[model samples]
Target: MTDKATAAGELTDIGNKRYFGEGLLRWYRKERRDLPWRRSRNPYHIWVSEIMLQQTRVDTVIPYFNRFVGRFPTLRHLAEAPEDDVLKHWEGLGYYSRARNLQAAAREVVEHYGGEVPRGKAEVSGLKGVGPYTTGAILSIAYDQPEPAVDGNVMRVLSRYFCLEDDIARPATRVAMESLAQSLIPEGQAADFNQALMELGAMVCTPKSPSCPVCPVGEHCEGRLQGRERELPVKTKAKKARPVFRLAALIEGTGAYAGKVLVRQRPETGLLAQMWELPHIEAPDEEIWNRLDEGAGLLEAALAEDGVRVKASNEVVGEAQHIFTHLVWKIKVLGAAALEERYVADRTGYRWIGPEEFENYAWPNVFRKLLTEYFLLVRRG
Candidate 1:
């Protein structure tokens, strides 16, 4: 019923699958990292961990995840929280959109899924931002389904084992890996097997300088046999370098009180949305200083950059440098006198809040710290 080539291919697939399970599992059971996420099977906890772990390191995610779970223990709690409150809890986590998305997805779950994290892969994947990998992880580890959640660790392990040189981001690689994973998804023990493979790759079959000699399946690793472990998981293109930006903001120094700073809320979209930040300009120019001299600095240019419209009516106080994960913003702080106008017309998306209000305004930690440092310097001066 089968030709020799077909039979050989099947046998090879079996060998690879069996070798992966035994090797990775044996190693994982022994050397799995003592991560907080591993301590629970509750779908909500698993869901939170999966979301936080995206594009973030395990070490970096620990405190944030702990704080997030402590603050919002369940889906219902997160679903009902205000966006700013959620952003407050998510401070310093960078990638604020993930927090926003998590809350959005939570609301969807409460409304449509009976306040429970969906167990079906299709249902889970269909949520706001859950992708195939997250869907697989939720269904496999949280729901104990035989779904495979492939991440960077899994990609590296598989690519090295199969000696695949294709870029893991490519769909062809995903398809091939999914096919292999389907064949290997253990008949009845999906959770342990999936976790075991992930743990092993994370702790042993790591991307760089993996522990090969102690690897339980080192003998079966194609890359190991070929001495090409570090060379697998080849990326198609290098990440392009982002440009640096100078930040300039005005603080109301000549106002009625004369020492307080000026800050406004960013729009409720794009980067740093709904967060309180100082009135700033990109190319701090002659027009900025001219407006500052008249106690009515201009904010029109910056607002235009963000596709909003507002007038400039403030003065300069100071400046600061802020480094983002990908972009650097050098902020110029200017203490300014306020204009006697309080309407949404100032900006379709802005609010003028005083010092006390700044604490609860959800400014990025970088800006918050900058304001603090600037104040301290002025006090000392």
Candidate 2:
């Protein structure tokens, strides 16, 4: 906790924003990191950086940010672009929902906000996916508004400086932390003030093995002075490991001369929704194929035909792992023989594209890599 004398003194100077503001500004001028997002005061760039940084590391976001900014240099560019193209750019950098929400928010900005990002908290927060932290981030960092932009880094810094006992797991912690941040925020250039605290947390007062000796506000850090640097920023609980689900299917009856495979479009919801993949069913054990049609079975039943024969039974083409927030899929592609012109129609269309045309379609690179590796090793084995 802040010493009584120091708290009382700082509180007395609260009304005089000039003093606190200049102090923070001076420190920030000497200590801020050279991040790409910090190079410019563009609201759209700040918004993109904040979104990409969610559940993502800063080092990992550098290249993604560069590529993203290169692709969509402005809010108008992103608003007019297609969602899939944006999502494709965001692939490999997981947490795909961010990309979708970003596109939605961009369109709203162009349509509603007159093509400019909102500078106020209420307006920024009302966007589709920008939350309190993001709103503050954009407002302060981009517009130099007096918002604290409190994120995990800010929370840790505040928690340790105040030696806060509140568990950060609770939503109320956010409310309290933001309040405290606002209370201490140096006025005028809210940008530098917010960046100072964030830089302090990220670069010096890290989660573990903090460099308290070199911290800018070392004298003011209550936790550091009390020999509790590592214990100040209390965390909540740990997450349980995600459970894995497996799915597979046998492709059969299709002639090798025509060179086509039986694939299906997944439902328009849930994991990898709308993505095309080979027909498969999720089964735990004990011959999952026994319950499905092979040649004159499920495929024929679904296709309403009997002119089919099983070529490959259950040839595992190897496994590809896909992960979501709460789910994991160990996907196995079972190769099989298939007859010509035997495929389901309507909402799901099965096409036989030429081998060279594989690049023409957009498939999750994970599955594409899996298929490539599987085919390559099959010939060797």
User: In terms of TM-score, which candidate is strongest?
Assistant: 1
Candidate 1, residues 1-381, lDDT tens digits: the string is 569989999888887778778766666777777888789888888888888888778898899889888989999999998888899987777778888988999999999999999877777988998888888888888878888888878888888888989888888888778776756777777777778777767778887779998888888889989988988878786454454434345444343434455567777798888887766656444343444543232445544565443344343355556555666665555443344434322555555444555577687876788777666665686
TM per candidate comes to 0.82, 0.79
Each candidate structure's count of clashing pairs:
24, 10
User: Pairing residues by index, what is the TM-score of model 2?
Assistant: 0.79
Q: Candidate 2, residues 13-121: lDDT per residue as tens digits?
A: 5633344345556777986778999898988988999899898888999999999999999988998997666866786677666887898899999999888997767
lDDT of 1: 0.73
The reply for model 1, stretches above 4 Å from the true place, is: 5-9, 250-259, 284-358, 378-381
Candidate 2: global Cα-lDDT? 0.69
lDDT of 2 at 278: 55
Find the candidate with the highest lDDT and give its number. 1
Q: Model 2, stretches more than 4 Å misplaced?
A: 1-27, 249-266, 276-280, 284-312, 341-365, 375-381
